[model samples]
Target: MKLRAYLLMLAVVGIWGCTFVLIKDALSDASPLAFNTVRMTLAFLVLAIAYRRHWREINRHQLIAGVIVGFFLAAGYQFQTAGLAKTTPSKSAFITGLVVVLVPLFSTVKALRPVGARAPRWNAYLGAFLAFAGILLLTVPAGSGVLPDFNAVNSGDLLTFGCSVAFTLHCIALGHTSPRIAFQPLALLQIGFCALFMMISTPILEHPQMRVTPRLILALAIAAVLATAAAFSIQSWAQSILPATHTALILTLEPVFAWITSFLFLGERMGLRPASGAIIILAGIAITELIPQPHVPTSHEA
Candidate 1:
């Protein structure tokens, strides 16, 4: 069970990590909102068909929870897809992985969650710290020594930063919701909300049009089916089996996968300073997860 959970988390992060490049490719023909809408809409249909007869699968509350979750997913992806057009997928991936860092921080928010629950462990705190350090290494530039020319104020980077923030919030929100809801219904409703909002947001933000090219079609199918649909399913399954901290730790490598994919497939180059910065960030994340844990006393000890 432990091995299966570990592999499941690995597969989820690996597949999700590479999606930025796919998004970049898919956006060549479709606008961000249009792209999101199509992906969610198609994924909705596919899942819906499978669960069509399973009305008893989810209650009304779960459906509502799913839709609410979907909205956050759409918001995060909308900015992320838009940002990927400007920044390299590798950088975006790392920046995006900051969600792991944000999860612990957000969990403490007075409004985000009840303080009644057991607090996260010291290792979780360290993971958040390492994750934040990695973000600084990658995103901050004025004195970071990585990109002298790296415009810290670039509109594109800021947009990607927005992506990071929204995604972080979404992941944190998932940490709360996933534990309570049934996975299938939650996923189905989540994407349904994403499709609805993105379909509307696309027209307001960008011209809603797509040129049907082989590459674009391929990209859309891959993202919608593989990344969005399959990835969501896998995440839901993995989250059910693994601790949330472990899931975040594994996902911390998302940027590494993104960086590698772009370097090999898209030939997006990261200069030495920035590349080293990414490595620093990744090292921090790994350490955050792999650090030893302190023993907890049982009731009998008292």
Candidate 2:
């Protein structure tokens, strides 16, 4: 069961990785808020139609929780899409990948504060550090076979970092909220609320408009159906059985996949450094999950 849940999340990561190019393309024709509003609304409408029979099962608590969770979800995508407009896909990916570190820190702090959660295992920390380094290599342009221009950091990097933080909160929120409610209904409500929030905020914040072009429609369909609806459903159901730290570690592969997709579709060259970085990211995941800590005897033991 645990293995299946991990695999499910891996699939979600794959779907999300492909979305980077699509989103980057879509944002050229529409504002971030406008694009997100339509993407999420389309996702919500599909789920609502499919699960209309279960709408009555959602309670007040679930409705409220879903809305709260949806805010973070929307904020994450909003910041990510907005940032993608100003940054390269690889740079945006690496910056947003910081959640691998944020999730464990958030979990560790929460555990220390008498929150009933245990501190993250040591392997999780190691994995997060390794993944962060891998992402750095995978995303940054090479100079002298290692490292990129640190001065390349800009407003887009900062915004994508905000996206990372928001996504980390979303994962943590799911860890707390998913087990208490039906996954489908909660996911529906969450997507619905996200769409509503984006719709309400788009006009106030930006000049919102969407062209009804075929390319735009295609991107929206893929994002709304595959990335938003299916991915959220998988994540919500999987988090019920996995820790947020573990989930974050697995998701660090997003940049690796993003790089691969770009190389294939966008004709971006994948050099040796990024190839090594991808291997390291996979190793980190393996070390975190496949490793076993040494057993320490308690005082009562012989």
Candidate 3:
């Protein structure tokens, strides 16, 4: 079961990685808000029909949780899609991977809260630190052979960083809520809320144009079905059983996958620094997953 969950996370990240390029391509003739509004709406419609039976299961708490998570999810996509337009797909992927670091930070803080719980396990902290170092190495620009030029940072990079924060919130919220709610209904509600938010925001914020090309249609369809509905549903179910830290570790592969997709589809190339960073990120994930965890006892235990 654990292995399957890990595999599912990997698959989801792989799809997401490829989307950096696909989304960049699709945005050529389409505004980010309109594109996201349409994709999310389509995803919500499909999930609503397919999971119609689960609608009866939702209650007030689940609806509120759904709204919270859905808002972050939609906002994250907005930042990411808009960023992708102004940045290279590879760079966008690397910046977006910052969530791996943010998740552990949030988890550590929660654990350290004076009233609520004990601190996080030491290994989680170590693994998060390693992942942070790896991301630094992986995202450094190839030509500069130096650390990221922060002074030269563009709007896209800032937006993508915001995307990371929003996604981190989404992941943590899902971890907190998924176990308490029915996964199907929760997933539907979250996506539905995102669609609703985007529907209202798109018209007001975006210029609203779509060329309806075959590429655009394909991107929209794949994004709505596979990426949003199927991937998020898998995430909801997976997080119910897996730790958020573990999920974040696995998701670090997203940038690597993004690099690969960008290479194949967008002719992007990597240098020694980025390559080494990718390897380090994988090692960090392995450290998190392969190491035997110290047990955390439940309240029912003696």
Which number leads on lDDT? 3
Model 2 residue runs over 4 Å out of place are: 1-11, 111-115, 127-151, 235-250, 270-302
Candidate 2 local lDDT, 175-217, one digit each (tens): 5776577777887888899888898888988898887888789
Each model's lDDT = 0.68, 0.71, 0.73
* Ranking of candidates on lDDT, top first: 3, 2, 1
What total of clashing residue pairs does each candidate reach?
Answer: 0, 0, 0
How does each model score on TM-score? 0.84, 0.78, 0.80
What's the lDDT of the predicted structure labeled candidate 2? 0.71
Candidate 1 lDDT, 1-302, residue by residue in tens: 87887897687677776777777777788776787778779888888876676657778778777767777778888887778777778888876665545544565565665334544456657766766655565665645554544455456667877876776666656656776876667777777887888888888898887888887888778777877677666666666677755765677667877877888889989766567777766765555456422211000000
Question: lDDT per residue, candidate 3, 46-132, as tens digits?
Answer: 999989898888899989998998898888888888888887787787767656545545666654232333455566567667766
User: Highest TM-score: which candidate?
Assistant: 1
Ranking by TM-score: 1, 3, 2
The per-prediction CA RMSD against the true structure, in angstroms, equals 6.2, 7.2, 5.7
Minimum summed lDDT over a 10-residue window in model 1 is located at 293-302
